[model samples]
Target: MQYTAMLDFRTCFDARKDIASLLKQEQSSGVDTGADTGVPRQVRVLGQERDGAVLYTWSDVSPYRQDDVVVSHIGLYEPISKVNTVLFVHEKLVNLVNCTVNQERTLLGFTTQEKAATSSSGSPSWHSEGRHHAQVYRSYLAEVQPANRVFYLNIERDNYLMVQFLHGKGQGYGDTSSKESHMLFLIHKELIGLYHMKLSRVGYSGVEMCGQPRTEVLAKRFQWAQWDHQRQRLYYLSQKKKNSNSKMTFTCMQFYEKHPPEVMMEVQVRIYLPPEVSKAPSTYEHLPLSKKVTDQKLLCEVMTLPGGSLCICYQHPIMNPDDHHGQEEDIGEYDVVDIEYSVFMLHRGTALHCCMPGFARLEAVNIKLHFFPFSE
Candidate 1:
């Protein structure tokens, strides 16, 4: 059987195995920055970050001389929406998992393969632009703080990841339904050394096999509209009809506001054959045509939205590498962008596991899902 050339699948055995393997491997070859060392087994511990040390350089950061190395707190989001988590259990099969992480509207890790697939008249190919890298998304989560933004960050698996739990027990079971504890991934870098990261959660709605009672968030109420005046903001009202009193505060941002003006120039000439019009205007804003462009054939082609009445305008992302248009997948996809994110809900499960004193049980929580993939 072919195995993943980059990593050893038999990873994470025990701390003794991890330290012993590290020392053994270090003795033969010194661990240098950017050096590709063999992955060690049992590389994780109950309360430590491992992935941080693996993705970036572990350089000992110098004292602040610039005093301006700012860490911008950005809300990274999916290029499109995601519905399910792809749990990774195999190593060699990484490439087999065909998916579009289109979480950020722009393509990353896509190669020429997916690009060609997206270039057709109806659907242009784009997945082939970025290199195919292993991507993993985990879903089961108990609220650690009762609130978490549903988004993900790309990180290496070999590095130390700090895994926290929902309850203090870290048993990863139940307790106060309210999120209290957390599991973190501590990464290792050659320069920065270690950084802590929290795992992003995905939606798990239909899990009959799990046998536990899972709360279902019936997406019945989703109201959004825009005044489109100078305010440039869109108002949205969403509520859960299945469980009355459950309110959903959803937001969206329209990133394609920078669409190049779609202009159609026409010349108006009343006379059948006017004496050669000899004017070369500096600006061609006004063409000399008046036979109004009314023919449906003359109008640019367009597709109707799902309602069968509304028209949809699909714009491509701006080519600038720095443009946020590339980052408009979730909230940014709306006609307006909001800086504040909030969620307040009151749910009652017809049948939910009531926790026993020291023993907790498996739990499933509902996270709103709206990510839809589109070529950037």
Candidate 2:
């Protein structure tokens, strides 16, 4: 569970040397090593890691500028097979990389550059447009494998969302094998798109759509979201404004294959702020005034606790506007500032319920709060 050593370029170079020596020995013994057939000569190593005893090295085909590193050609070095497979050779730049929870597949997000076309008059014309793409590749060591395009996204080029992969049993998607299924989730602001791709032993069920892609647009912007793969649930918190008051609403959504996703539970609680404190200003000329505070500002965060409970922590800043009206001369002398914080837990069972009054406190200085998930 803990890392004993860091894997770097040196590790890859050392592994490559060992593999080269092994290959030379096999060749000398008249052994047929057909795995390394079409590896290129020039490649710069980017990253390398080991899965079990097999070493996987990622490299770029062409030399790149140190100021602007744009990865166009990607390759993978397999030590066991003695093969350096080219994963992708693109005309554009690859910007994002994400691996599945099982670390068997890697998702690369990149942009396609617009190619110049020849005009009717024999002049070159630029398209002035580009596209965004996401491609999945097999990261584990294999005999000879090529990258696959699971699905294509039509999102705008400028709006790049982080791609997340979830692998589990496809309950109602006609997948009966014990092999886990693969699905991808992309979040763009308040919109969440879920795409299902069943990965077979050989490869994935090609680029054809397995099922209709599911999308959910929330009413309000959410702070963060957490997915529970075991229970097949998604939880998020959004804030709703009612007149001059605001309340945080927590929602849980359940996913299914045939039926539409449904909300399993929702809870809303009004945020309460402590009373503002007022103090007489001192006549000290050297004192400095406190920074101006907003009328009623609320900061909220959510974390998942152990035993399937949700913990929400929020802070409210209390400031007195009337005390600053005539005290501009002695603003630095008044020392009355407070911030109130509250923490509560929501438990789920046959029926969702909120635990009894949780902890609340007021402090003079603003305290940075960090909530540890699944910690005792």
Candidate 3:
């Protein structure tokens, strides 16, 4: 029994030694995570092994591969002076990771100088493209006059960030002397017979919006259009209530908000409308434009519910074998005709859900049901 115990102990020791050797080899091979020594405080050029579940490395940084641009690597320069190093080789900006901190620490993006960040936008000032990020799709855009030298950022439901910059400055066509108008939206909710307007300066960073919720003055700044039915509440990245700049809302648009606000950033102004309990299509008299509504009674029925789902399902019989006897036996088709139904959740307060498909509903016999809990 004593001999057997000794043998067992020896075997365990050998196994542990083998495991350690394997781990050490993995570290050297860059296959095992234990191999990564992390980056040093001082920058250096070493390749990353893999990405996601496996070790993957990019051939280079900066999605732009052109040679006409300049690149810069900005790092935390004492957090105050902020070192902004400009690279003359490439046009697009790129950051290189040189060193790692420790065993548990990871190398992320580089920091930049404060002065470079805050240097001159409207009147030579740096700004941060903060907050208000999203991805919008299939919409139209009209430039606000006297471009505020500000950009708009679009935010989406999936945490996807986008940017839109205001490229010009000056008032629209006829008003050359007026202050450049900012294209922003006023978000609001209605209660009973009353409307509460909340204003925010939304969209991109460079495009600065007036900061206030006053309706009478700012209402004339924007052109209203029929909203696409495939959406829900318009969101904005706000700094402070009654004092903030909002990221613009609409689809398929992104802007740059890469830095911090060099100047005071705030949102202001709003346009409010009272609530209407009925979402069913009303009539041509209630419509904003002909393209905005086909049938008011039908549209009135498609709006979202207070915490309930939008069941836009048409009540027609489906194309299944049970419902479509006329087609008779395996015709080699999907046998599916989807009806339409969209849903939007009420975020606490009572807000009307808008669903305007621009077409008549197929009813219960045939309907295209949105396969999601919320429209994208």
| Candidate 3 ranges with C-alpha deviation above 4 Å | 1-66, 69-173, 185-376
Report the C-alpha lDDT of model 1 over 93-206, residue by residue, as the tens digit.
111111111111111111001112223454532221232322321222211122232223333321111112111222222222221122212121101111112222234321
Q: Compute each candidate's TM-score over C-alphas.
A: 0.17, 0.44, 0.18
Better of 1 and 2 by TM-score: 2
User: What TM-score does prediction 2 earn?
Assistant: 0.44
Candidate models: Cα lDDT each: 0.21, 0.40, 0.23
lDDT of 3 by residue, 1-376 (tens): 3544322223422212333333345446655221234321122221111110111111123224433233332121111222111111122333322111100111121111111222234333322233222221111121122222222222111111111111121122112232332222221111001111122233432222344322222111111122221231112221222221232121111211222112121222122111121222112222211112122222212233445443222222132345444544444334434433323222332332334333322233333333323332
From the highest TM-score down, the ranking of the candidates is 2, 3, 1
The weakest ten consecutive residues by lDDT in model 1 span 281-290
Residue pairs clashing in model 2 are: none
* Residue 193 miss distance in model 1 (angstroms): 37
lDDT of 2 by residue, 1-376 (tens): 8877533334544544644444345546655422222232233333332222222223233332434333445444555656544444443344323322222433333222222344576655432133222322112111112344433455432222333334334433334332333343433223455543433444553222234444444334453355554455666655554322445577877765455568887887555322321111111111011101112133445555666666666665544456456544554534445445566666632222232222222333335444456454
Off by over 4 Å in 1: 1-88, 91-215, 218-376
Error of 1 at 96 (Å): 13
